[model samples]
Target: MSEQTDTAAVPTPEAEPTSTPAPAPEATEAADVATEVAEVAGAPEAPEAPEAVTEAEAVTEAVTGAVTEPNVWAAPPAPPKDRRGLFAALRWTAAVAVFAAVGTGVAYGITQPERTDIPGLSTKDDGRWTFPVLSRPALPAGAPVPQGPDNKDGTHYAPLTGLLLPAPEGAKADDAVKADKDGVVSADAFLEEYTPEAREKLKQSLEWDGLRQIAGRGWTTADGTRTHVYLLRFHSSGFVDAFKGCDTNARFTGVSALDLDDVWSKAKNTQMNSTTLDFPGAANFDGTDLSVYQEVKPFLGEEQTKIGCLRTGDVLGMVIQTRKGEVAPVTFHQSVILQSQLLS
Candidate 1:
C-alpha cells in the first residue's frame, strides 16, 4: 500500500495532453502573420491616370484669351449712316476721280452731254472754240485789185486818218461823208480780209443789211489783209461798231457808258464770274493774265471810262481766240486810254 502510495506520489507516466489549450504567445504570433499576409494581399496598386487634360488646358490658354471662356471674336462697329454735305460730296468726287484714274466712267455718266464740253476748253481737243479758217484770195502778183467792195454806192467811209491830220475848223469828216464816190478810204478795210460770200453771210447772220448796203460801195483801202468783221449795235445807244467774229465761239459784249459805275462799292457786290470768262479778265482758261485796264490804270485818267465786265454768265461777250496776243488792243497809243470819242 505504502509502495503504491509512493508510486502514486511520484508522477505517473500519463498519455500526451491531447485536449490542452494553446499558449497565448503562439496564438498572438499566428494572428500577427495572418495580419501581415492580409495586408500584402489586399493593398491597392498604383492607379492609371488621365493624360491630355493639363496640356490641352495650357494650349487653350495660349491660343484663346481665357481658359474658361468661349473663343468667338467680337466684331467692330460700322460707320454711321447719315446724309452727306459738301465734304461728303468732295470725298465722293475724289473717289470718282480715283475710279476714273483707274479707267472707270461711273462718276461722270450722270451729267448732261452739254456739260461734257468744258466752257473754256482746257483740253485742246474739245471743240468749243472752233471755226472754218477763210482761205486767202489768190492774186497773180499785181492784178490791179479794184477799189470798191462790189461797186455799190450806198455806203460812206468815215475817214479816221483824217482826224490825225490838220483839218479846217467846222469842216468835219462826218460832214463830208457821202454815199457816192467819197474820196477818203475806210479804216476797217485794214484789219480783216473777207470773201464776198463770207461778208454777205456774216452780214445776214448778224442782221446788218443796212451796214452791208452801205459798205458795198467801192472805197479805197490801205492794207490788203482779209478778215471777217460783223457789225454790232450797242443796246444803250444807236452807235454801230464792227469786230472779227472769226472764231464763232469767241463773243463780245458791250455795255454802254450809261451803265458805268462811279464807285467800286456796288460793283464788287456782283461777282462777274463766268466759267468760260474769268473774273478780272484772264485771257486763257489755263491762267494768262490779261487786262489793259489793270496794267495801264495810272495812264487812264480818273475821269476815264472804267467799264468792268465778267465772262461767266448769261451776258454774251467777246474773245478773239487767235494765236496772236493783243489781237484787239484798247488803243495803239495807250493801252487803257478810254476813247471818250469812240466807245462813249
Candidate 2:
C-alpha cells in the first residue's frame, strides 16, 4: 500500500486552496436588525440625558462663557418703542390746549364795552365805569310864562339860573348869589336867618320838616331898594298846603300874619312897628303880606321893610324889600306873581 500511494502522489494534481465564502443575505439582515435593537435599547444610556439644563443654568453659562448649544430655548427680545410717535402725540395735545385757551380769551374780550375818554371819569380794566356821569335835567314843557335869562357860564348853577327871577333892568348877575348846584344852605343854616321865636315855630311846621332844597338871590332895584328872594322846594304839595293852611282867613294861614308877628317880635338891634295886610290878587293864592318899620340911630330915619311869601305846588317863595320909606304892597305882590308863574 505504501508502494502504491507513492506512485499516486507522484502523479496527483496539487490540492486547491480553501477560502471563506460571503455570508447569506438572510443572516446579514438578521445581524443588522440585532445591532439596531441593541443601539436603541442601550446606546450607552445616552450619557444620562445631560441632567436637563434649566433657565438659571443657561443664564449662568451664558454669563460665564459663550453658549455652544444651537438648540437651546429662550424668550424672544422686546420690540423697540416708537419715540417719535409718542412725542408727536404730546405736541398735538399741547397745541389743542393752547388754542382752546386763546379762543376763550378772545370771546371774553369781544363782550366788553369800548373804553371812553372823559376828564374826572375813567373806565376800569374790565371796561366798566369808575364814577357816574352827571348831566343837567331838561326843562319841563309848556311853561306858563317866560323864564329868566339863563346863566350858562355860571358854575353848577346854570340850569337853575334859567328858572330864577330876572334882575332889575340895569342889575347884573351877583357873585354873592352863586352857589353849588346842590345848594349850600342846610335846614339849620337857613333857620339862623330868622328870629329865635320864628325859627322855633318854623322848626315845628310841616313845610320846614319836609324841606328839600333852598336857593336864594339878592337884588337892588333902580331906586336903591334892596330885595332878597328865597326859593324853597318842599318834599310834596301836601307839605306846602299844610304850611299855608287852606283857609280864607289870612291869620289862619300857618305862615301868614302870626308868623310875621313872631318874626318882628324877636328882631334884634331894631325897634319895629309892623302891620299885617291882606295881599291883593292873593286871596285865592297861598301868600301873605307884611309891612314893618325898623328904627335906626335916633338921628337917622326909620328903615322900611316889606315881606311877602307864596307857595305854588311844592315850591315856596319869599321876597323881602327894605328901604328908607314905606314899601308898597303891590311891589311884593308883583314879585310873588312872577315867581309863581315860573313855578307853574
The best candidate by lDDT is 2
Per-residue lDDT tens digits for candidate 1, residues 95-213, read 99887776645345434444436464334322122222312234344332212344132111322221111212222223212223433323244123333334545545444422222
How high a TM-score does candidate 1 get?
A: 0.18
| TM-score against truth, every candidate | 0.18, 0.37
Looking at candidate 2, what is the lDDT of residue 269? 19
What would the per-residue lDDT of candidate 2 be over residues 261-313, giving only the tens digit for each residue? 23343421133222222223332332222222222233124455555565554
Model 1 scores what on Cα lDDT? Answer: 0.28
**Clash count of each predicted structure:** 12, 0
